[model samples]
Target chain A: MNPTPDGFSTRHRGGKKSAARKVRRSSAVNRPSTVKRGKVVSVADGNAAIISKSFQLRSMQRAWNRFHAGSLSHWTTTIIIALSLTIFGAFTLLLSNANTALDNWTGDNLVTVFLEERTSIEQIESIQTEISKKSGVDQISVVSPAQAMARMKNMLGSEAGLLDSLDDNPLPFSIEFRLTDKKYKKTANLVYEIGTWQGVEAVSYDQIWAEKLAAVIHTFRFVGIALTVLLLTAVALIISNTIKLTIIARRDEVEVMRFMGATDSFIKTPFVYEGVLQGLFGAIGALLLTSLLYWGGQGAAAELGAAFGIFFELHYLQVGQLLIIMALGIFLGLIGALISLSRFLEI
Target chain B: MSSESLPLLIAKGLKKAFSVGKNSSLEVLKGIDLSIDKGEMVALLGDSGSGKSTLIQILGTLDRPSSGVVTLNGINLFALNPKEQAVVRNQKIGFIYQFHRLLPEFSARENVMMPLLIGRCSPKLAKERAGEILEKVGLAGRLDHRPGQLSGGEQQRVAIARSIVTEPVLLLADEPTGNLDSRTAGSVFELLQKLNQDLGLSCLMVTHNNELAQNLDRQLHMIDGCLAEEERGK
Candidate 1:
């Protein structure tokens, strides 16, 4: 006999005649019994194959059915998750805009040393050279009294006639230099050292307000992160409780499936899918809410910036940040489902 | 070795105990030794709490014995891991509960298709087999009826169809007709008998109906966690 691909052994030609003769003699009584055993064994082997795609589809169907059956509760949990994420997203938007405004304010890092009224050009040049030689100085420029007066007139915009009525230029000659290191302490120390110079009348920089704003931003960031953590934890807990309720409602069905020999994965997969679906929908809702908030707040924020004479524009979350939020929602849902299943689902 | 000589299922010295208190335990099955041959329909009769259900559970691999061995087709059932045992239950054993236990949300056809689906059979084949078996149990016209819509007898017929749809080697029925009227119970028992004769499906049924028990191949009576008497039925 030769082994065939379908796992049956084929008899050679010599036995074929006798096999056919025997089959013809008692075909009704004998043929089907042997064929029936073979078919059953084949079916059993088929059963032992990997889990079918149909099973997964059925689980998804069941999950969707349960989700529909508890629409009110599921939607309520989803809204809670959306609201939590919206709050977090709002804080993120605020911090992002604040940080951008602060960056623009401190970007120049310029220090101005005002000269005495009678300082000579030679003295101004000497001060400029000395400032340029400092450790953190990048670019130095000498601003004559006339140039300073011109800058003031330009700033006054449509009021330059009032500047001309001063009868004489009272602006002081100054030397400005850009600092490579913008640290408040470094800039302050440099200003103090320059104030003691021979011909320098005063020294000033915008480091104080920048440093204060930076501190405020840091504090706000910390608080926002802490708040987001708390809110997400609460959301996860709510999801866990919601899933627990559904499990309780279906407790009898679960027990029946277990007795019918459903695998643990088979029983639990639908619940896991339910959690994931909740998270996915919740995240989508949060994104939509956050977008609405951004559009609603954009014009108001711009007007507020104009009041303070600062150019402020609200930027929506970056692609990476949006992805992070979505991922967090999904992860929280998974964790919540796992928590409930581990605690309540004994099978 | 012929199929008739080798029993399809055998339980030797099976014992089960439950811890009742800190220092006390309740024994359910002191020790049970039983076997059911191929194509044999055996009836188990006992009063309430006589360990009949526990024995059925153990033999079906739904529960484990505290000690002793249960071999189905010469394979030690308890020796397999839970996952493998579940596979055995899915493919080799079928259960018919007293309450018909059909998922109320699904129709009769879907309920009957469940075991085959659990065994990873294709949905189309499961549906065809389920429909065929439902018709075989005289429920052809009620395939779409949910359990809530079906009468008690019709529900039991659906349950029978589900149990036999898998074509399992052994059917462990715990009071399959317990909740039906005598007329309904007799009809259900006749269906079981017909399936046994036509399909050669082996069964171990727990029942309180002695009249029905007397028609099976054998009847074992349980009394206080022990098999007290055995009678060959005609």
Candidate 2:
């Protein structure tokens, strides 16, 4: 039955189709792998002819083959996802810490009490003593009008005469009270208490600064949450689509695996592993960048502090937060890969 | 032997169709009724687009029949769910195509062990079985080579090793040697003949080669999606 053809061709048999063909049998060997059933122990010759009706054997083998074959892209994707998530974690931790420091350090809670013009030194001293005992007051500093002017002159040397030439001491005698916590409600309560004191002409706290602080805190929390969610959704999508593209590129390989009797789970394992690997790698990239930024910021802060007595600290990525970020990145990659694979496995 | 007495694979009035172009349905196969008995090598010969591939797909349970029933051994194919159908396909049937569909990323031995692994056989046993089969196919030394590294004929042999490693009841081939050179193609056919003789494996092949088709135990020619002639051959 072997044909000795030199090249590819289709020879037409003189009509629409050939008719009355004869059948011949040849004892040929070396058949295609698809047809060759290897020699094995059998109870009867007919038992070999009767194809055993079991599908699990081949599918299991295909799964193992895929894993060992390095056909799995899931591992790679997982690493990338893990890395991206770590960045998010670092950002969230640093942001929260920064907010806490700002709320604690702001001057919004400082209260100043102006003394009455007719008030004597003895009366002012008693008022200062009473204000210091207030529950919210952290500390109180008393500045007399004359002392205030002297201090202003000592600092402005050249402008000292201009300040002294004033017809009267323009600076008022005042007692400044600081609050423990910068909560606006607490600050207002303290202000109300101080304003009711005798010999006090006026009581005011930095209301504008208080309002600004409130706005900053609110906006920060809101923007942080929104950005994190948006970035995560984007990351998830990118990983999912990337895995899907990989699947499409390797569809033929998948088909081959299926024909080998691979189950859906078997076919999906390698892809999931690859996704996780990708996520982890991405997370590591983000961490490296975050680490560099932290180091650079700390260096800059040190230079600034040396040049001028101003201190600044950029929040760094905490270990716990870093771990969570890594985990999240890996999770995102796996989920994304699974989503893409779900659609293809149905076939 | 009477048709009912010979046990292998039987499809009664099997029909398959596919929808194309959104609304139009093209019936690829008009009802086909045939039986492949034990130890018989049946050849399905037809030109391209004559539903030859479609018939093999349905019979192998890779695709569903639009109508009628297919029974492999004693189990009804259409009655089983997809998971169970997959189980049936894995356990009972083997397949060979013109193109060696051995996974390129996996070694030849690993490819052969796939079916056994899927069936939950122990790794040790699967490995031993795979080793034995690969040796039989004369690929003992090339077991570690992936499909990409092997010649076309050798790759096809690996594919063959994978298909029958689990000892299925029926093997389906769709022009198994159509992609090989004449010499290699002949050798591949010879291996199929050997497996049939040595193991009594029942085989049904779809081919355009009349010479290869005629060598089977029985020849069924398809014209316009129906069996035109059935001849008993040497």
Candidate 3:
């Protein structure tokens, strides 16, 4: 008999034939009384159970371990994510500034009606009363010819001296009013109707420029959305591929874990966390990059505004918008991990 | 009917076949019937192509038999779903491969702590148990050493410690000492024998060493997808 490490002789058992017969006989009547029905025993009791806090904590630890082990690849993927999100953020900034500028320019929704040079002051008053009665018209102002000429001189700045050559005020008296309804079509109809009225020489409104600007903003929004979708998809694919490489590198580890009775979630949760971390860090980096762009572009934006004779200010993303970008980054990372895990990690 | 009388594992008519190409099939295990009682150590001796590893895998729930019923602790292993089978594998079975298969990135203690962690054991408890088991396997001083930093014998000892750390009812080792030299292989075999006796851990080890096989309770010799002989150990 073989001596065991404890210096005792190993127990001598029956022959193979007797043991086989016993096993066969036992198999015939084998029914375990301890078997529980419809209830899974906890892992602590030497049975399979769902993931516990300890398991989740270990998974998180492992994710960090993996991130550290493969920092180069992880950082590369993170940089790509950061760059993609930065582009998205820049587009958002541009759209926001354009929208703010449009709002400032169209805030009053003012329309101007120029009267004939021969029109009497009483006629101008009657016309103002008529326009005030029109639907959606508010805040009527009557502009005398001298008042119009004075406004022109103010606008002309240093060139106001050229207007002194005129013997009389050549500007026509005009009526200006704010439209409560800012729809282009409605304002156009109102302007056309007023232009045909007696003593009215021409009718004009800034609604046309507002409408054009709105159309441009709409197109920019569409293109921005399309580009963002494409770029985000690319980011997801990059993350997925990076995770796939990690899976491949750790294939043996996965198999060993599987054989050790690791649940699918137990095996998958760490990878998911890895993806989430990558996305989170990438998003933070993108925010920094976006902030730098905003700060650096502030002076240039001011110069452009001066050139256009208007004030343009670049605003940083609001809290809600920043939170959304962060959330999107996290979501994309999660999706990327799921995609890779689903295709590559069978367990 | 009694727990002591029932074998720890029982397989009846286990068969495994693989498709070769189109019309031909390769049969690896043809109706293999086997059993290992609690605290019994059985040595499976076979040639390279005799399906010993395949049988071990099927018994361990790592691979499914084409047609068979594997009962462990009186539960039909194959009858359970994949998830349930995984739990059974985790809580009831421990596996040792020839190459040790210790994760290169982890320390010996950490590697041994893995199965316990996978079973949802707390890290502190796992660490303590890992330390205790590593001390048992004569690797207390090498607890924090990685597999690469250790010798082959030390690595195998770590693997042994990892396998028994969970206190699994059944240990399935596939040529666990196949890659070691004779001296190291003998020591490793002795460790397995000792663990089997001391812990009453049922073991089904596949190996080519007839001398080591003779030390077990029984020796099962497989030839060409069949058990050709069964001999009682010395």
Q: What DockQ does each listed candidate score?
A: 0.35, 0.15, 0.25
DockQ of 2: 0.15
Per-residue lDDT tens digits of candidate 1, residues B1-234? 754578989999999999999999999999999999989999999999999999998998878899999988777888777666766677678889899999897889888877665654444555667788899999999998899999999999999988877667899999999999999999999999999999788999999999999999999999999998999999
Return the lDDT, model 2, position B59: 87
Find the 10 residues in a row with the least total lDDT in model 3 chain A. A2-11
Top-scoring candidate (TM-score):
3
Ranking by DockQ: 1, 3, 2
Q: Write the per-residue lDDT of candidate 3 for residues A1-347, one digit (tens) a residue.
A: 32211111122322234332432232222211112442343334322122344356667776877786665889999999999999998889888888887887677688999999899989999999989999988889998888988888999999999999999887899999999887788889889999999999998887687789889999999999999999999999999998998899889978888888876776788899899989998899999999999999899988977876678887888888788789978988899999999999986
lDDT of 3 by residue, B126-195 (tens): 5667888899899989999999999999999999998887678899999999999999999999999889
Residue pairs clashing, model 3: none
| Residues A1-347 of candidate 2: C-alpha lDDT, one tens digit per residue | 11111111111212222111100010011010121131212233343232222222333333334334443354444444544554565557556655554554465467889988888889888998887777767678898898878888997888788875688997779888777666677777777877888888898776545467467767876876787778788778877887787788778767665665655655676677666656666777667766776776677655744553235566676688778667766777678778878865555
Q: Which should have the higher DockQ, number 1 or number 3? A: 1
CAPRI docking class of candidate 1: acceptable
Expressed as tens digits, the lDDT of each residue in B138-165 for candidate 2 is: 8999988888999999988998888888
The most accurate candidate by lDDT is 3
